[model samples]
Target: MTQSQHMQIQKTVFIITYGRSGSTLLQNMLNALPGYVLRGENANLLAPLVRSWQGLRRSEQAATMRARGTPSGPHQPWFGYEAIDADQLGQDLADVFLRQVLRPEADTRAVGFKEIRWHETPALFAPMLEFLQRYMPEAHFIFNTRAHEEVCRSGWWKTMDRRVVLDQLESAEQLYQDWQAAHPQRCLALHYNDYAQSPEAWQPLFEFLGEPYDAELVEAVLGRKLMHMKWQKPANRP
Candidate 1:
């Protein structure tokens, strides 16, 4: 579709969580909905774009101060920096993401990806989310979480220091909670343990998205596991 058509995309959904948190399950469920195309992880690719936009914004501010109404010229080192429109640049980046990365089809109503790397940079988490909300069209965030103890014992996390893993998981959960508390209308928080086996448990999630809850679909989704890996023991364990 054309860029203008892509810009017409009215709804977007994002699953924000750490790895091994049953996010793939959520992704699959959301994709099952008609006209919904929730993709898998992109390694938090948008984070760097957000960072670049932020850096450019800072440079623009600094240039405004240093130039003091002087016209920027090619002869100067920071020439043309003051002319940059950081907001437009940010919007263009978001457009590229929607058209190229998400690549929603003609029938797609909602498009997004489930990313596990948001917690990797605690300092940038809020900024990155803010950038998305500002640029992406009608963005909605789904914060997925598993129990900290369960997460620490799952997959590769089992090989890491339990205390460290738990701390990271808790910290990420706190960030999700804070964001959701601040934007209740645009956010939904889901716990894997709470809804992993119960279709009724997912009613609120469906309601939040304004999608009809399909019990049969939910049951079918829960019947199979996505990205399930064999348990890995810590290297030091006997």
Candidate 2:
């Protein structure tokens, strides 16, 4: 797309939230957007000093850790495409992510990172919002959610580890409440259950991203049927 055309699309969506919240399903849906590039869990900036950034959202997490005088927690990994260099990651994440990887995956006007972590807590991710506004100045964010009990259950099944499961449950709700209060307009909150329950649930998100809901696209990306269901790796659940 040309510069004028790119300006018209005017959206780069970041899926910011915890695991086991149906983010993958959302990622799949976003990936299918006409010409948009979607890179899932590609945030590597949460670490001490990795290069390619996880994106503006992870940049916020990095700022949070600095303020707290604490190191990045273990569960919060520095995720990204292995092709990226640790040093040049952050400042250029969006550029590289768009040009090298995501663009090739889907041909679209907008592109984004789908990886997220502990920044789920608004307080935790406070640093991120400001960073994102400055970094990919054109980017937008999505604060995704699911029922607490269901999140816990799904997290547990996905993460056999007791500690990870516990953390997700404790953090998920707070993250939802926190990000919403702090960053309202930029952060669009939605439940994973709705994605499974009805096509209408995604209309707002589609509108937010400046894309129309392609019944064919949604169905093709989210196979089987939309239902109150989920999936996760054993490590992801608590």
Candidate 3:
């Protein structure tokens, strides 16, 4: 397939975060902008797809190493890491994402989704980021975070989901930091507390996205009674 066939979207924006980290709010805000529609989470599909690919690579590595009588030694699981064709994997994943996750809309100049599982599946971040960088040249990433304690206290965590929440958040943050360091212009790190305190605090994000900042739209969406829990902070208090 041609390179453009694999990367059909004009611009792809990913809001990567742990659950209960205000990614939905970020999505809503971005969607309010003209020609931008950042959809909700798709971890149910993305996580399993990524895990299966990793498992397949590991299984192949084990089979190959055993057949060749090669000692796996300390890095047994990643024994054949170098043998994996990342470019081919990238192409496959790009096709999967375009087919499964994104919804095509002619009016949408940028189409994207928010996914929380990137935190739990930290190993997939680098490869996926590389793939995104290669295929979707105009891609932007928003790494949203809330306070660690706040996340732990949130409903999502309190409901018996044990995925090493803190560790996952830390690892995800590190991934975001590393990616942002390399591509400063295309990555944005945002804090839920800051944005919740003042929806207008997201002006920098709008600026980074080259979208006009609209305080009214921010207030309109944020002021409503939504399904998600209230941010519990005074609006414009900060």
Candidate 4:
């Protein structure tokens, strides 16, 4: 499809979390919803696209500087890609995502993906987050987190240093917190323990996404283990 053609995205939802943080379980529950479709861990696909965009801006800046007889340096302002029409770019991105990463099903009402790697370096994820925000202003974000000690004990962190793991988790939590603070209407901060202890905790999530709460589906999803990480109750759970 041509970039000029517009894609009408009903809703765009992003699931953001660090590894072994019950993100996969949340993904499963979100996927079970009637209108939402979220793909898991597409960092391999998304990271390249964002980096390529950065590269393209650098190249564009160099060429523009050459044309203006100005020396381009590392300190030059990043080109904003303002030349590209916002709506067209947004639609083109949607097309690329749906076609390449997550193909739309017949009844797909909302589309998005989940990735844990973004939490490792939230700074690197900033440009991509900005891209999503600018293009899909209506997009909703779910910031999922698990207890620090519990995450450190998980198999995913077994080989890693506990201190480093804790720091990374803290950084991830802070990134999400900042985003939520800045755009409360567009983000939801959810803890894995809270959701596990009471499945009804997902009511806020469903409300955030403008979806009907399906108690039956939630119960069904909870009945079985969807992700490899088993539910771990936190020490401070009330």
Clashing residue pairs in all predictions, respectively, total 0, 22, 0, 0
The TM-score measured for candidate 3 stands at 0.72
Off by over 4 Å in 3: 1-9, 47-89, 159-164, 230-238
Worst 10 residues of 1 by lDDT: 229-238
TM-score of each: 0.91, 0.62, 0.72, 0.78
Clashes by residue pair, model 3: none
Error of 1 at 229 (Å): 3.9
Model 4 steric clash pairs:
none
Please, what are the lDDT tens digits per residue for candidate 1 over residues 155-181? 888778998888888888889998888
- Model 3, span 1-238: residue lDDT tens: 3344434556788887777787787888888888776777654355555555556555765566567766555656666554556457755776667655676465667877887777455677765665566655488888899998788777646554445767766787888888889888788889999998697788988898888888889898787655667544322212
Full candidate order by lDDT, most accurate first = 1, 4, 3, 2
lDDT of 4 by residue, 1-238 (tens): 2322224457778888877788888898888988677987765366556655555555655456556654545565744333434346444675576666766566667778887777554555666676666655367788889989988988657568899888888887888888788878888888999998587898998888888888888888888766454544322222
Question: Which model, 3 or 4, shows the larger TM-score?
Answer: 4
lDDT of all predictions, in order shown? 0.84, 0.60, 0.71, 0.72
- Winner on TM-score between 2 and 4 is 4
Best by TM-score: 1
Query: Which of 1 and 2 is ahead in lDDT?
Result: 1
| Local lDDT at 53 for model 1 | 89
The C-alpha stretches of model 4 lying farther than 4 A from their native spots are 1-8, 55-94, 227-238
Which residue pairs collide in model 1, if any?
A: none
Lowest summed lDDT window (length 10), candidate 3:
229-238
